[model samples]
Target: MNAPEFKKLPGVLAFQRGLVITDALFFNVLKDSQTPVMVVRHGIRGTQNVNKDGDAEKSTAANAKRQEVSNIQTTDTAKLEEEAQALAVRFGLRFLDLKDVLFACAPASTDANDLVRNYRDSVTGFIERAKTSPGLDEVAQRFARNIANGRWLWRNRTIARQVEVHVSVNGTPLASFDALATPLNHFDNITDAERQVAAYIADGLRGDDDAGLDIEARLDFGVRGALEVFPSQNYVEDKPRGFARPLYCLGSPERAGSRNGIEFESTRTMGHAALRDQKIGNALRTIDTWYPSYAEHGRPLPVEPNGASLEAQEFFRDRKTSAFEFARRLNTLDPASPEGMFMIASLIRGGVFSGGKE
Candidate 1:
């Protein structure tokens, strides 16, 4: 019920869907908190097209002209979506529709977007609009709180109002009372970092992790570090060892009523716990992905970045999640599962981009 109560939390952990796709990072960060994937997708805009026939099919044809949204083959997409849903069911988590969210993220660009001379403005026009919504701030807080509370759910679609329980999943990590072991069933008999690296890279490199969903990639430590963020469920293992608490425990938040804005204090009640989780799946795999990718690559940057962190690793995780899921969901006919599809849709529509990109 409170942030401090989570100091002993074992069910929370940071997570990333694919390699460093910016959108994918946002998807995992913001997934199903206050809003469903549908609302966010309302923001995605694409360019307009002119129909070849010019009159009868003008509207539909026009859409096809500028950008060709590949004709989605429902068979493959549905299969992937269903599999994710089935998996979530095993974990007691729900799945959301991706098509609705994709549409929201990929909005119809307007004349103003075309008028902008700056390239960033042209492509980012939709993203800019989406950012204006206060809904984003609200979602961030809701997501944080849900993780703090062991297993919470949004009771209403109107996330702006008072919080409710048992109504939705953005707040829930899909836990069930059972003799649950590590969902490492995807990991198998034979073991080698080589196959692990290869398989993980393949999913992260694809458009979305929704395709060829394999659990074998979940074993690495590097992937866990990168996703060392909130709602820490991804890091959790089974009872004995996985139930470590938060490294930095902050006290319950209070509004700085008389101050300029909001403020809070950190509580030193705890020392630290290993912030382990899915970063091992995507982030660590990415370090390997990059070495080979850039072995004989493009021209050197204007100047190498001087940052301490390997941003490239994080970025890889985001892209892989977004790209793989986008391709997978767009192709799905009936997405009964909520895990990847909804999160993927929200992220694509959310217009999440890696901060530093040319």
Candidate 2:
């Protein structure tokens, strides 16, 4: 029989995210009670901008006429209450089976469908090999390190004097980590607790169990004063004057117009300050040390198809290192290699990767 002819990828190909994360809810811990931290609107006075260019007399006059203006700012701020010692953030994580990674794949034509059918076994073999590979295990280890290090806390982690992370599998308590003591910049060294967590995560990825992991992280500022904590900020296209920043919050529909209610993304709410699931997932998957510039940059970026870093304003990967290129050569790559691991990790990260023709 003639070999199957395949020159291009399927027109519609996508993978479901393997590492599923839930939105993290924030709570203000006060003595024996835990309450949801609500977003509040603050009204403050600020001086207006004064033109200081051109004529000196005009500049002086403009400065003199500049008046104090009332500015209303709406944001979500979490703090340890006067009687509280810590702020708690709770979220859940689910690791999907890599064996069932593909979410969608629609071939453009009958020939293409035949080609994919012929190539399916090769792809399956690669995935099966990856399951037992050390490279994949390393990826899982990095993910666990992020959890143990409290990287998901984002800005809140910076202000925390002490952080404790509690993890559980299903409902059973597994391990706790001293998040403050764990380094965030590198994953070269991992404590025994981090390794334990990584084993569970690796098992989950390999489809050893279906039950997910639950996590709760507490940040202690070591002070009774209200120290501001950061929550995920919402993106508003048409922000009103003085309302440039908006924080994310969750509330019930029944509380929409109630006296204790506030806007979902704006206004003072009886809701809770929380981080988005996307943000949480991004933190968990910041394990792309395989990127070319990672050695020079000294930081791991989130696994992306292009090794893109929005903050750095650069794409670290060229065509050779891109996910598309890796996918193209998946059948030939050694599943235990770093490049192969990164390709599989990208699939776990999940996205539309249809390369229509050529």
Query: What overall lDDT goes with each candidate model?
Result: 0.23, 0.77
In candidate 2, position 146 carries an lDDT of 95
Residue 318 in model 1: lDDT: 41
Q: Give the TM-score of candidate 1.
A: 0.20
Q: Write model 1 residue lDDT over 1-358, tens digit each, in one string.
A: 1121111111111122222221111111122321111100011223333455666444533234445544321110001111121101001111122122222122123222322223223223322322342332222222222222212211111111221111122332222211112111111222232233233222322322332211210111112112222222222334232122322111232332353445332221221111223322222211111211233432111101111125443232244333233222222212223222233223422333222211
Candidate 2's displacement at residue 43, Å, is: 3.1
- In model 2, where do residues sit more than 4 Å from their true spots? 1-7, 47-76, 109-113, 253-267
Residue lDDT tens for model 2, 1-358: 2133236666777888987788999888877889887665444444444454556466523333535454334434445456667899999997888878888767766444465664455557678888888877887888999999999999889888899999998788888999988878788887788888888888888899767889999888767766677788889875665554667777742244344545343334545778999999998888888888887999988899999988799998998898877876767777668788888789789998786756
